[model samples]
Target: MTPVNPESSTLYVQSLATGVQVLRAFNTQRASMSLPEIASAVGISKSAAQRFAFTLEALGMLKKDSQSKRYSLSSANLESGYQYLQCHPLLERANPYLLDLNQRTGETVNLAEPADDCMVYIGRFSSLARLIAHVPIGQRIPMFCASTGRAYLSSLSDDAAREILERSDRVRYTPQTVTDVDALLTLVQQAREEGFACCHDQFYRGDLALAVPIWDAAGNAVAGLNLSVSSTSFTVKRAINKFVPLMLETARLISTTPPNPTALRPFRTEPRGPKEAG
Candidate 1:
């Protein structure tokens, strides 16, 4: 006959839950986390957090800090994500198309997906001029402040889209940033009708971006494709008229293409180093 201790059982459960929460905090933002930082953010006891973190470290899922004695995520998570991408034939096919668009347009082109209340640029090609990328790959940008985000939101149900808007603080990145929830909702509806979204100095300070949703065979846009140009390069009307159509065509080509057979990868699945993490 065996009996379990109630207090011990509760302790084990809290430890497990706290460990997962600790891991969640290591996204694109603030990738590397110190023990104290993690404990504060997870709102867990220091001893409990340390035990959980050491467990993850033993599992080869967290790298320890020597000087600061903190911790960061390891590379093991990338294998799981890479395996999932291997199954998604669409993302592979879409790559060559993205590359071609970059070559032809002479501007940066990006593909993004909804993440929390924002959109993360999953794939992108850079232009001749270097840009200040405040939101890098695996990072998030607000739905109201990014044309790519708005394009993705515009394709979703109104109730669902409105919920995202309501949750976001709509921090004013620039004077052009749309912080009004009602007005942002209206803009999303208009994007749906126009089949694209355009915004100037919204997501980026000097960048003007035109984004459109890429519809799959099932008629759902699982992601948004965006063409971005600096204000110095062109005006809004010219970008819409000259580049929008090409962008749509390139999206379809990439969307319909076959999965990559090679293993070369660029996306980040684990916590990034301090230098790259914003």
Candidate 2:
């Protein structure tokens, strides 16, 4: 039966849908909502909402504020959303460009989005390897250490980047990983100036990933496009001379699109070959 009040339907009963919906209800503004507030926001009974929140927290979907006993969403939701957009039309507008890029660069072309504290590889065009770097589509890389992460981070506001960095673990992934906050801040500044970011073996062992940011109509870096090669195939110099320009071209094409994101198609994966690390 329809609710007597339309507002009530949006504000109340629909809140009772599932654990997922309840988890989604938490956002930046509602960061630390109390159990009762969550119940009202999702239109669920206090007991049931608390149960769902507890379950979500157990699963790392929600975090309970130790001080206030409120709840907020964990980074897992961001990962799920990134994976969804990766395969959808969100990357469609960029597929042809990526394919051309892969052919021209003769390397794996990857599209990524800011997922949790890292830029997760979403779309991939593989050649010479079944998939480059053995990085699954859901794999997470450190924002400060990966070229894709830096490219997007450079496009974000200073405060936003620092906030995320401060909230993250900032663990040392490799000897090359820039775990120093001050140094990363400086690198971010350089990336903003140069219009792209490059990292060699920072995100993964002996992996070279170069990336540029794709902006939305709002001028926000909504996505990142990258070319990844193993330490055996291309040198940092070769990536810059041969691949950077085309990668930037793809980024520009995608950034110039209307508000909606474009989708990019995936090619083939091949065996890892010999190349120099960038």
Candidate 3:
């Protein structure tokens, strides 16, 4: 991740920031948005939004519908993410293991990285089960509530983890979501000691997940690997006992894989979107 000095603002480009914000306004929920809606969502004037939209459309990153006069992301927009995954050595090495784990458990598996106060899903393998949650890649979940986030936090120093949790929005997503700072700190400490983290219905009701942090050659927690199952299919205890070993093994395998000769840059922090269950 590129380090930023918050005190320095001269290097920041406001136009570029606004352009990126305009692009992020398009999502599964808001697949297409009119210029007015975009302006409101991005907190910009309609003329500025129109300029951003026009520039994006001209660049082939967005397309405007003639009938509704709304703009939507185009296939070209996916190129950036495609290039990211293609160059990420960790995801490249972990793909086969994630596939194997998915087949063995018949459950969803996720590869995620901590970004700011959330964990973003960068890679995922879907379960064959008929009743699984639809968690698309690029979905973000709060660090305090997600198993993957907790696992990554566990690998950090207590003070670092506490700082992140303090900055988190902490909006209660479910009854199980832990908002208390002290309680969450305890969970992080426990995960650090146990080498894994488990969350039951915290991010979403009826969803259960287990995760372990993936370390890099330098011993930094580069990513987190998660196994997600439905509460109806297995108890939390049962899921942890059955999958924790596999998760740890997969994390170790990813950690030991050498970095790509042409290293990939880490993902940028974008505008926050709706949270999804991991």
Candidate 4:
């Protein structure tokens, strides 16, 4: 009798997984990829990459350039994310409050949920004053340095937060990023004590962000709400003093809304392994 390979279980569709991996290989760093590049990025053979690329192109999920022979994500790739945001219960409840904060402060307001060691931006309202070039919905920022990340971390038990911090890559994104685990733990502890987190030019230079965690009805932290203002506009002390109370109020108001049991339960305080690409 032949032994069954557990990794090739009948319930798991390896081909579908590989096809998704091929699409994920194209990201902000590599917006367009050749067949060889796709194969190398996805750890698949060139022929398999070609087959998956062809299938994805046929499905309207990828577009192939005739001249360059490189594949890029199509408009169809956005449909899933759009559908998710449109239907997400948390975003539905939080939007009004987030918009209010944005209008009041005239700063960029964002809502992020934890994905392993990174915070994924799910909601954003641009500041009328000036828009930051990089932040878009679906962007991921490191949990070790971002204000939203720290706000979420502050909701977790110290041990769990430490585990996450220790597992993070801990590279300095900017000179201001606190990469030491002990120092980061101190910051999380301070955030826990203060009921909010603040970052000054940590993730991006001249970007100052302040954040507070959003909790579910069950007292689990499900997400974070943050407001970002440029250093050119306000000093850190002034920004904190001006925005912290208002942000706390906004986050508190949003937290009161009962979250979808199934949609939100996964984001509670437990540490996660590295997130998988969709």
Best by lDDT: 4
Candidate 2 C-alpha lDDT tens digits along 154-218: 87777887777777788877766667677777767656766767777776776777787887867
Q: Which regions in candidate 4 have their CA more than 4 angstroms from the true location? A: 1-10, 257-278
TM-score of candidate 1 to 2 decimals:
0.78
Q: Write the per-residue lDDT of candidate 4 for residues 31-52, one digit (tens) a residue.
A: 9999899989999889988899
For model 2, the local distance difference test gives 0.72
Query: CA lDDT, every prediction?
Result: 0.73, 0.72, 0.81, 0.83
Give the C-alpha miss distance for residue 179 in model 4, angstroms. Answer: 0.2
Which is the winner by lDDT between candidate 2 and candidate 3? 3
Task: Point out the higher-scoring one by TM-score: 1 or 4.
Answer: 4
Per-model TM against the reference: 0.78, 0.63, 0.85, 0.87
Query: Which scores better on TM-score, 3 or 4?
Result: 4
- The list of candidate 1 runs beyond 4 A from truth reads 1-17, 26-34, 75-87, 130-135, 255-278
TM-score of decoy 4:
0.87
Q: List the residue pairs that clash in candidate 3.
A: none
Off by over 4 Å in 3: 1-11, 257-278
